[model samples]
Target: MTTENLLVELFVEELPPKALKKLGESFASQLFEGLKSRGLVGADETVTSYASPRRLAVHVCNVFATAPDQEIKKKLMPVSIALGADGKPTEAFKKSAAKAGCADLIEKWPNAEDGPDQLYVANDGKADAIFLRSMAKGTSLLVGLEGALEDAMAKLPIPKVMTYQLEDGWTTVNFVRPVHGLVALHGADVVPISVLGLEAGRMTQGHRFEARVDPVALTNADCYALQMADEGAVIANFAERRAEIVRQLQAATAPLGLKPVEDDALLDEVTALVERPNVLVGKFEEAFLEVPQECLILTMKANQKYFPLLDAAGKLTNQFLIVSNISPDDASAVIGGNERVVRPRLADAKFFFDQDRKKTLESRVSGLAKVVYHNKLGTQGERSNKVELIAVGIAAMLGNEKLESAVGTAAKLAKADLLTDMVGEFPELQGTMGRYYAQHDGLSDDIAFAIEDHYKPRFAGDELPRNDVGVCVALADKLETLVGLFGIGEKPTGDKDPFALRRHALGVIRMLIERDLPLNLDALLFVAAGIRGFSEDVAGQVETFVFERLSGMLREQGYSAQEVDAVVSLKPQRLGEIPKRLAAVRAFADLPEAPALAAANKRVGNILKKAEGEMGTDVAPDRLVEAAEKALFASVNEIAPQADAAFESGDYTASLQALAALKAPVDAFFDSVMVNTDDPALKANRLALLNQLHRTMNRVADLSRLAA
Candidate 1:
């Protein structure tokens, strides 16, 4: 079979900058997968994707001109239905054979009782009569490419669509943008296909101004990228273009003794927006620096796709770098235009900052009354009040009554920034603006930091609140969200978490487990529910949700499912003890007696679950009949205390190891003892003995989870 590399491209009006990278990747991968599924390409073949502002393309290696022929067998109608009373083919069988393009073979069809093909019977005692067995011809590259391209286009992650008319003016097409050209090549030959009313060709437009020629002609599939660069003046590959920008930014900023603010998302957007990138240095007036540097950096990155520079101490400077699509001999006009344009943006930031400081954050307390938090949950003012109460209670629990005043003050001012001019203009600066305004109000540093840090750990892997006061406020805020939302029955289902309750739950878990706070999770949840006047049952639901999130996070952190299950299934009140319990379980699993012990523990759990009446942990040695039962009771008496002592001392590994000595007695007891004997006292005593063994084995973790 002969093979050749294939090339595909779609040239269009500039794409959405943020979605270009994903679109290109999806297009290439989907096309490759589609071809491979049809046996047109092999698994080992390589695929290279190219994306620019105006085009998306892919080059796939080792593509076949046609897919291999396949043998197909399709089961037709039931034998009773296809055959008439005279046992001959009926009109229905004729139609089916014609539909399958095998009309001439209908007369040759054998009866179900004596045919080479197998017959399938229906549940009604009727047999499916016809089986069409034939060879299917392969599709040529041109035809297969058309279907593949259409499928890939339909599956693109387009955020929005635009409708434009073709040259005929009567026909319109919807796409991410108006597509002007499509190129499909197999080796040196054009595998002609059409998309968005444009026919496939070998020529595509390049950079608007810098291209040496208007339409760069691709000679073959292998030379597309090289020709695109040499004649089109465009770096077609997205990753390559991004890397080039990074290199140019480094070379440009090194001489200025500054560094560009690092944001991968910003870099990718810029790469997608320009085909021929030229980095230029620009600067604004130093007076604009009086505004917060965060405002300046954010404005430069968000409003204009400019990279702000930072000094040696990571302080924002007036200088920034711009990636331009054009390169001129003087370059002064381009640099001056960017500087002039950025001056007004920076001036607006300074104006908002100045206007916001006119009123202290303390004065904004009453302003929250009109701002509704949730229709069911009341206003932000009411929410703040609830948070204040929760924070004070948490502070007391941490043995720090001094934090009550600070936490209350911080919680009161946390949402105040939402009403400020700076925050209104840039909603991402809510907590940060509060911190700045609080300092201007002559507030203590502790209170100011606490207000800003109250929303910490907003996402996964984010830092927690900085201090005890911040911890109190953050915990209160998150707990309020969980309790209030769960109370209203707005829990997340599937992928829809409009309120980010899962994130809040993970934040609470991270704070408790990472900070090793002595606060009990259940107590905090119950108190939070109480603040909202919610049912006490919400605590159990909230606890289960938090533990589930913890289990997933721990598994992601490289713990095995069994280890996590062993610890999390116990539902220990002190979440901080989970990691210790997991460590202990892992250590015990390495012991020589672990498998037998885990099996015994599981058996004991099952026996206890099925046992009738009250099964107490108290075992009377006098009631033990068999020597094995006596030996097991005696071993439990000796080992239970040692395990309990080690557990209380926080030596979880030592505690679990102490139970390792029970394997022999446990196996022997289960083998010899009849726990369900007719004698009432003896049965109860045996159940009690097993109960003691179960309790002692599971102190560190639910060892039954480790059972295979």
Candidate 2:
């Protein structure tokens, strides 16, 4: 048989560019799959997806011209249930039996002597709507493709689906936008299908400005793409359009003493903006070049879609270029229009710079408190107060008096620009604006830097604190946020982190680990206790919760979860020292003889977990064990304090070193003496030794379960 193609077009009002491709792809694939599973004949297939920022269409070829005959599942009721005890047809089963075209046909095919078999035939009809409805009923016991396809369309995935239309506008379907009509045909025959209220037809319109409505018929499977091409449309993939834009942009800018700006994202954004890609060279005032290149570039890219260009030395070239759908001759006019559009944006930047410089940055500081931070979290003024408090505490701890004011000043106006109209409109500049304002006011460079750097590393793999002042204020900012939220019992739960406590915690981690700063969570909590509104219990709970974030962070860094648990199990108050301790423990753990020593540590842990709140610091070593056991106990007594000293001082390497001293002695004791010895006094002494090791090891990290 000669191959025949099928075509469909859901003409719509202006559709969101982002959603057009997604909806088109989904409709084509889902419809194709649905038809295939129904045993439809589609010898070869291709789906051409195209849109014009207004309409989306999927043209399928060599697609099912008609459904193929196949066995279908049919359901039958037991005749015994269908008939009444009086040998009369029951109304319950009679209606359904009649609809199935088998009124009382069940009597001729009675249920077997045993009982009903409960089998079903999904569809038993000619290839058309009647068959589709039958197949739509769930064939599988569970939800099959029927529900999946419908559900997939229920909440159309991708952008712009949110702006639902009140009336089923031009699209003919009630959707996020108004629809126009549906054009569909199968093997030159119109397939009866309705999508978004648009009925199947064989005609499609093209380029609202370029072509008229035409009844273009797809000839063959391969003709689909070329057919759409003739309709003032390119039915090729989006990636082709995306790449073509880049190539043309480069070529257009090549002779203009400029080069296309290297920006993949900007390219992607531009691609979504145009249907037929064309690059047009444009020019701007060379005098505007006196302004910073970044400001000028931002103006063109953000406001005009005109990509800035640079010469050999990377100085801003007065000319810029843009991509438009029109021809080269037409684009010259478009370029002129874009260049004219960007002039005002550049002028505004220059004016803002001039106006900002008229006054000192100090004058902007007063504007900070007026800025609202959060509805309930008070103004930036209140957050400023918390930031200053934290900075002061950290400064004193670091013994850096110079950093105190810089840190405090940075904290004071960290959010100063939130009050500025610029930052209000462009929130990304909150910290950066504050830094600019502070520097303009003639504040010390360090404070200005801190103001800007405090929010560094906003997301994963971002830059972190770059200076002592920045680190101090950064830690304070993150800690205060974590504490304030957790105090109110607003912890992050699976996929819902309204407060972004995890990022704040990560910032804290990167600051400590990357900067190698000495910090005590206990000390940090004590400072957090100063937040004023928090209760003592709330303060403590928030503190523990933040500590858990650290624990989880460490575990993710390839440390054993059990190893982290061991150290945290010690009622940890100082967590900044944890990573170092874990590293040191991990290092010592890798020693060849570490397993037995780890076993000793695990045995020690088992004793403590089994103690079930039985014991305290009072270990009765007066009840001595055998001489060898006594020697091991003496060694533990000596090294325990050394380990404690190192741990308390945050010298975890030293702590693990001291703890490693016990490995040999403990290994010797396990080999020579049994803790469950026949003598009660000896057993008690060995138990005391185990407790001593547990307590000492607890100072650094719970090494018992640490993986080598």
> Candidate 1: lDDT of 295?
94
Model 1 steric clash pairs:
78-128, 78-129, 79-127, 79-128, 79-129
Encode model 2's per-residue lDDT on 1-708: one tens digit a residue. Answer: 343565555566766654555666676676556544643435356656655565555555554333443444455445455557985557866676667755535454333222222222233342211111122221330122234234435555555444443344433323656666666555556655555544556665555554423545555334545665566554244566787887887787766756767877677667666667777767777777765566677667776777788898887888777777665555556767777787888778767656656765556667667868676677767877887898789888888888887788778777666666455545656677667777778787788878888887699889986688888888888878877777666888888998888888778777766776667666776786676366667667766666677777777788887767766666555455566767777776666656766777787778667643345444575676467667777887798778778766778777777766777778777778777667755566566667777777666666666634
User: Per-residue lDDT for 49 in model 2?
Assistant: 63
lDDT of each: 0.90, 0.65
TM-score of each: 0.94, 0.75
Please give, for residues 1-708, the per-residue lDDT of candidate 1 as tens digits. 899999999998999999999999999999988888777888989999999999999999989999888767777677777889987789998888778776666655553333333333344345444666566788778878888888888889999988889999899888999888999989988887887787898999889998998899889999998999999999999999999999999999999999999999999999999998999999999999998899999999999999999999999999999999988999999999999999999999999999988998989999999999999999999999999899988998888777888888898898999999888889988888888999999998888988888998988878998888888999999999999999999999999999999999999999899998898999999899999999889878899999999999999999999999999998888888888999999999999999999988898899889887777888888898999999998899999999999999989999999999999999898888899999999999999888888888898899998989
